[model samples]
Target: MYDHYDALIFDMDGTLVDSGQLHEFGWSETLNKYGIPIDRPLMRSLAGVPTKATIEILLQKFNLTPTATLDEMNDFKEAWVHDNMHNFVKPTALIEVAKKYHGIKPMAIGTGAYTQEAITILGLCGLDKYIDAVVGADQVKNPKPAPDTFLRCAELLGAAPEKCVVFEDSKLGLQAAASAGMAGIDVLLVHAIENDYFL
Candidate 1:
């Protein structure tokens, strides 16, 4: 089905794994500790952003100065998610796409999560074996919407950016894919269309 593409790149959180709720919980806990109110809409809008970047955005949005540094807040949030992710994280249906093209095409995960965190989450979901490379937010100077993450994945896979296809679940991810000059497939819309086909 992906014969035209030389490689497949996936977004980890909302794309390959159902860890959004866990992330939201982690963010909520961290923000609440600092007395910052939870902003669901803003959080959802920054779906593919890095934890530190998200914290920065949140602080800016709330118009509050933080007692904690961005790195400290990120560490807190990441620690919580890492502790609870294995209990709640599961592979999404888009994982089947990765599996289908596993051996036939090179596949990589480009995520806004930290490198080790992405690896840990993929391991929990039994997806680590299928992925050839992983590019995380910390691994590049620029994260999603800048194309650095996906471009790094393609580089690691030795695939041309224009010849790659990115499977993502967020607008930021899609924008990153486009910026990287790859085709983007929205997993949510794909699943919705698949459901309609069955109906």
Candidate 2:
């Protein structure tokens, strides 16, 4: 039913994988270790943002000078996720949609996750084989809602942004898709509308 779209772009975290809370927990632990306190709600709202950007924003908000390099903070966050993912991460219900279009249409992941992190999680969920391309934080100079990541995925798939539909679970991702000239489908509603398929 998504035949009109030349490509499908999926966001890795809350969209394809149930890892938002896990990521929030990771950020919390990392920040706590640094004696930085953060508003959990604010942290949750930054879901689709890259770790580096999130750290910068948090530091700015708290008026705290970064004690660690951006790379170090990013590394710490990812490591925390890596160590604890087995307990809270898994493919979300949207994998069914991804599987349905696996061979029929080109699909890619445009994520704020680090390249290796996205790769590892997709592999863990058995989704790596289905995704044709992956554009991660490491590959983009700008993160969502900047549109760079999603646009890069469309480029790698040789599809125009207007011809792709991005599945996202966060407002930042939706904004990115719109900025990329692509339609966005919220993962939360995808199931209710799964049968319709945007035909």
Candidate 3:
């Protein structure tokens, strides 16, 4: 299902890396410390949103005003996650894919994560230099499900949106790529599809 596209746009957390659960745990711990409870269904809806946008969603969903800046909360989450990454599993294919795609086609990362966080995690996994371009939450005005991040990523990669294909696990990320008129490869459904590959 993914072979037709020229470039592969990857979502960092749950798609290419096995760190979404860790992120959720970290976010829960950090927010709970601030007395910000995590609402399951609501949090899921914010999956592909920017950090600030996620905070806004949480605040409204939880019916509480933020006690701190979105940046501060995000910093807390990133710190907690990085501090606990040893407990998280890195994607086995990260380095191999980079090596295989060295000259195959350009690869870019479009994520709701902060650029610094994305770079740090990729660096920790030794997958940093393999990427040709990156579009992070900090780089776009709107996040996933809005097409801004993917559109910006396509722009940075010098690829047309329609020609780009995105690899994602979240429904929001898939919708974002589709909304941008791009093909989406749902890594979560890889096992059931002949053309899909598990990461």
TM-scores vs. true structure, each candidate: 0.94, 0.91, 0.85
Once model 1 is optimally superposed onto the true structure by TM-score, how far is the C-alpha of residue 108 displaced, in angstroms? 0.2
Score candidate 1 by TM-score against the native: 0.94
Please list the C-alpha lDDT of all candidates, in the order they appear: 0.86, 0.83, 0.75
lDDT of 2 by residue, 135-154 (tens): 99889888889989998999
**Per-residue accuracy of model 3 over 1-199 as CA lDDT, tens digit each:** 3456677788887766667667778877877877888677666656667666777777887789778887898778778877887677476454465577766778989998888778877777666777888778888887778899988988888888898988877889989989999998777576232111121
- Best candidate per TM-score, number? 1
Query: Which portions of model 3 show Cα errors greater than 4 Å?
Result: 1-3, 86-89, 92-99, 191-199
Q: With candidate 2 superimposed using the best TM-score fit, by how many Å does residue 151's alpha carbon deviate from the native?
A: 1.1
Candidate 1 — what's its lDDT?
0.86
Taking the tens digit of each residue's C-alpha lDDT, what string does model 1 give over 21-115?
78877888898887787767777888889988888887888898998887788889888988898777888788778778878899999999999
Model 3 quality (TM-score): 0.85
What are the clash counts of all predictions, listed in order? Answer: 0, 0, 1
